[model samples]
Target: MSFKSRTLLFVICLFVVSNKLVATPKVKTIPIFNIQVDSLIEQQSIRNDMTQLELLVLYNDALKEKKPADSVNIFKKLAILNADLGQPEDALIYTEKYIKNTLDFSILNSEAYNVIRGSEAHKELSENYMLQIDWISFIFLYVALIGFFFTVIINFSKKANRCAKLFISGFVGVHSLFILEFVLYISNIQYRLPHTYLIAALTALLYGPFLYLYFKSVTYNFKFRTIDLLHFLPTLILIVYLFPMYSLSSNDKIEIMLEINNSYNINRYVIFISKVVSLFIYAILIGKFHYSRRKEEDSIKGKKPVNRWKKTIYAIHVIYLVSYIIYGLPVSGLMLSFPYFINYIQVSIMSVMVIYLAYMAYVQPEIFKSYSVGTSENTIPPLEKYQKSGLTNALSEELKGNLIRLFVEDKVFKENNINLEELSKRLNTTRHNTSQIINEHFNINFFELINKFRIQEAIRILKEDIHGSLNIIDIAYEVGYNNKVTFNKAFKKETSLTPSEFINMQIKKGLYK
Candidate 1:
């Protein structure tokens, strides 16, 4: 046989063998669910380090086992994980599945909501979705909270009423926790501090009582009593009730969180409602107190009194009431939808309130100062009788001369702690008569009269210090003001310029050497 013909025959034989081998069926291997694989997947999920593929596999396994609750939770976690991993489309699909399988709307406060609201996929689907919250709101809220924190800190450091400082500190503590939760929610962080919820709740419960005390401190003579500690009993009881949960392990805490989030807990709802009721009651009490005080002042003085400071505080209380209502409606089931817009409104109001508070702290430091009239009765004969008496004119002139000498020559206004009673003592007259003399002769209250002298002294120092040897703070201390903010404000109010501006003007006019 020829070599080429023999080679062709061999090739045909090889092709026939290959066809036979291809026609034969091979055994298939199936993967078994083993303890190692299950353990690894669970560890990943527990650590919140599961990949999308791993989560899907676990989710499918849960579904295969007919574990609906486990499957739903896995799906919810998958949604959040995908969102954090920047897979918004997958996150939305998983979120839809979570909603469909569980029939649960409680995910509105979860990271899933943040993902959906911020996702372009969701935006493309619904342009008119007014329920969406923007990320800017979080930024604004954070800024406002930071401002509140610093304002409280600065106020606490000031020589203000101790009760007022304590109240502001309480507010700072409660709101700081709230802001922490808000940050965690927006960032999709899964970790929580132990007893965070309990601490926040207890602090929230203290808001009304703290506010009431703050008002009392500012509006009247307030002294701390042992009985005042009773206001914290509700918080103490709640702390005790939550002590067991606080001691739970991390896994146990996660389980409890899931249960709380998936369904309404009656106890939690009751506590929330109680908080709203307490705040509302406090608001009414504050309003009543303010109204009665204003009425008394009007009746006694026979004129409209300057209550801008008090009015600002009252407005803040009203804001708190409004915010509680807006927040409580959705939380207590009184409203179907959580009014996300209320967050913006509340933050805006709080920002403005903080700014107003800062302004008051700067411009009217005396508002925070404790002032009290002496016990001397206002029975210094009627004004008509005093005018009819020949001694009235002589007494008025003598009082005026003494006041000028004390304020200008003696520089008594340089005392930061000077008050109406102290000045009356210095003038060697009754507090009522001294106050009357200042009101009638100076055409202003004791507060304004003292500030006028202090501001004048500040101007004199600023004008004389041409070598720039004195800073604004130095001038503030030298002129009976403990804080430069207050001094600058008073200087501007009296001379229409801040201390620096006034100094610059004096320099420009060649008034300084």
Candidate 2:
């Protein structure tokens, strides 16, 4: 109750009240022991007040100690702590460092890091670091690589149609490069090498044109005219439009790529939509050409030339067209969503086309031969015997086609006096050029070619029930063989059987009525 004691009690009470009002700064405790992952993880969860600076110190200590596991754990903790603190840029840097050390993407999906999920830096981190190789990507890469070699083989092939093969090679080459670019995108290498960004995009314009050219060349023996070069205008324009981007430095390009919003780019949408349009238009053109040729073949009833191959190719074109449209819808922003797996459908269809082309090139190359036989003679040196001949390749090809038509369709070989001079007159060429065409194109002399056709005709007559009544001499004269002896000799040479023996075999097999 003394006044001095009352004043001392009041002062003590005031000091306690001031200490409670102005709180002490909580000290960040550092363990004297070495940093360990298990202890840090427990502390990170329990010590919610832990600062990123404390985690950074622990991460640097782990690195100095050459403990990779502890360093990666600290990096992840720093990333999450920064993300929760609303510092997405800092969080992204730490996230990338963590992923580089651990190759783990699980942290990206953790709800604890949601604050940074929509950040450009975070997106770059996910895209650049979350590298994966899907099985479909591998398959596309493998098939495209094989397509490259096959393209080379056919491009250099001397036996098939030169113009048609060139277009086929172009088609395969473009698809292979496009698929390779896709593989790189899937593998996250596109971000590393910015130059590869639009390389595949331009190739889209080429696919339809190449396919059209191939169909035209094979069916109609089409040679490129000046107007045909217009098919490349779109691709060339795209190249010019993209040139500015292509000229940018790698660092600048990557900066642009990392900042690009998920929304559609008008220029990109237009370019891609045009490609789909080009494909659609060319598909119709190719289908029209193919149908017209098919109708002609059907009317003539001559042996169909690569009819099956042409049909298969057109069918594949249609399939690819549908798949590409579906895949392009979302990618070009015509549709709402782009499921990444949708690309697999189009790429698989392209792979099938590539494989089918390889099959045709290997198994049925003869069907690809065009009417312009030996047109590649300019590239390949002429044979020694024909080096001095006056037969130009174009003229020789014309004569050869006509001569084949004469024998196979017109049955001119059934004429008893169808000598080289007579055949040359019918072909409207010099006897020497006609003779050279036979030797160079068919690898046989004029008489040998005529005799071979005659023998074939005689065999056909011998096996036919209607012609079974014709005797050997009568058949010999009918097939342009003046005598039975010459007919028997030619038949024996062609089929290892005389005319009488061929008829007997047919009779024994019940081929004749």
Candidate 3:
């Protein structure tokens, strides 16, 4: 066949196949009885005075219909109604059906579930079903925590600061224990790890101290001292007191677990309360420190106000304090008395907090500038002679004027990737000379100097375009910022007001249309 004939044949074959695939009819099965059941359920559910017996009748009819998905919803309604009517055993049976059909174990720790857990009828179902299905949540938390821990580790490795490293390490240790406990619980092998409870108890004692250290380290640039070891005394004492549990026989360990589980041990309650009290104290201390730091920064002139890192750390502490009050205190026995679903809700909140923490840590700004850390004053002579380079004072003055002209008239600072090397090249000078001049004259790093000009330009534009001609994001890009977040941060740092707030202030002053 010729080329055109062969191509035509292939096209015809593809078109026929495509049409057949598109025109094919789909097969679906529908349960005729489920339609009637759904209609009845919807009608009864909407009625103001539906009786428990009527709900039970619907549930029985749903079971006889043998439609698993529809029956599951009916079983859930029946469970709630039976429990309300004080028929816990019947409620539990229906709850089990709902859980099995839906693969949801959120009700495993409910009062009704607890009532039937020890009963002979639901023993296997309660123990096996609860653990098996809950493993899904456990695995998710485990993986997420591991990822968070390593993320912090990567941050610590880059900076190599003792205080921050220890702070993050302590948190990783605590989270590791949580993962281990979940593992043992879900695997039904907690007794094999007999020392788990004692270790967890001891670890809990470090939670408040480590958190305190983390805030202290970031806010105050703390250095670890011998006195700092005293903070671990409480954790040590806990380990010593629980030392006996470490060597207990398997049977004895099981008894201790039972006692702890039943809240029969007064010491366990005491430890929990102590941890909460300690965290509260640290939170107050950190709040005071933050206030002092803010006051100190406010006193400095020509410096950008608002330390975002400090605020982020302080917010984390606030979250910790609130979480302890909600989920830690004994008087806040809400978690215990509430449904099992409440536990998962708490877990979800903590997971979000962890993710936020990881994000903040990952993007934490440089605490120390490059020249501030390793370079010494003696290494470079005084700025008067331009030191080892032999550049005269007159020439340095000329270069400074030229640099100002480039920034002010040329508007070179608007470029997103402007840096010392680029600036040095523009000035036809060595990078070292350019950096020294910026440090000595401006008393700031290259990035800070660039951002200062950009922020000033942004303010000018905001004032000129008054009738909201350009939105905050558009203004950010127009002023040389590549993204809105960095622009907002820089603007707020310089002016102590967000872009929107600045625009509003301009409008109030009649500077903007």
Q: Using lDDT as the measure, which candidate wins?
A: 2
Lowest summed lDDT across 10 adjacent residues in model 1 is found at: 24-33
Which should have the higher lDDT, number 2 or number 3?
2
Q: How high is each candidate's TM-score?
A: 0.51, 0.55, 0.51
**Candidate 1 on 1-513: residue-level lDDT in tens?**
999999999999999999988772221111324323334345554444444555555555554654555567667766666665667787767766775565453554465445556578656323221233457646755655765665466565565667766675565455555555544443333233323434456565777787677667755557889998987777787677666666766545444444534332336666677787777877788778767676443323212322457676677868866886786677667777675777656545555655566556666554554333232232122344234433377897899899989998998989889999999999998887787677666656788888888987777777667777877898788878989889888887666678888887888898877
Give the TM-score (vs. native) of candidate 2.
Answer: 0.55
The alpha-carbon RMSD values of the candidates against the true structure, listed in the order shown, are: 17.0, 13.8, 23.8
User: Candidate 2's C-alpha lDDT?
Assistant: 0.74
Ranking by TM-score: 2, 1, 3
Question: Once all C-alphas are superposed, what RMSD does model 1 give against the true structure?
Answer: 17.0
Tens digits of per-residue lDDT for model 3 on 1-513? 999999999999999999988872221123335456546556555443345556565556567775565577677777765655556678767876775555455655555444444565456555544444465556645655664565457454554456666675666557455545655655545644555645556676676677667656644446789999998987788777767656666556655554433323436556667777777777787677667666444323222222455576567657755755665543344345544444444445445545555555556533311111122421222344445766677877878888899999999988777888999999999887787677656656678889889999998888778677888898888778999999999998787799989888888888865
CA deviation > 4 Å runs, candidate 2: 1-77, 80-128, 260-266, 298-305, 372-513
Per-residue error for 506 in candidate 3, Å, reads 18
Candidate 2, residue 338: Cα displacement in angstroms equals 3.9
lDDT of 1 at 239: 74
> Over the stretch 1-513, how does candidate 2's per-residue lDDT look in tens digits?
999999999999999999989873442334424445446655654444455456555655555665565567768877887787678888888887775555456787677667767878766776675555778678888998999998898877777888888889999888888788888877777766778876777677999999888877765557899999999998898887777767777655555555443232326677678888988999899888777666454322112437678888889988888888888888767788767787977888888888889887898775555532234322222357788776677877778789889888899989997788888889888887887787677655677788888887877777674547778898889888888888888788666677778778887887777
The per-model lDDT (C-alpha) reads 0.63, 0.74, 0.63
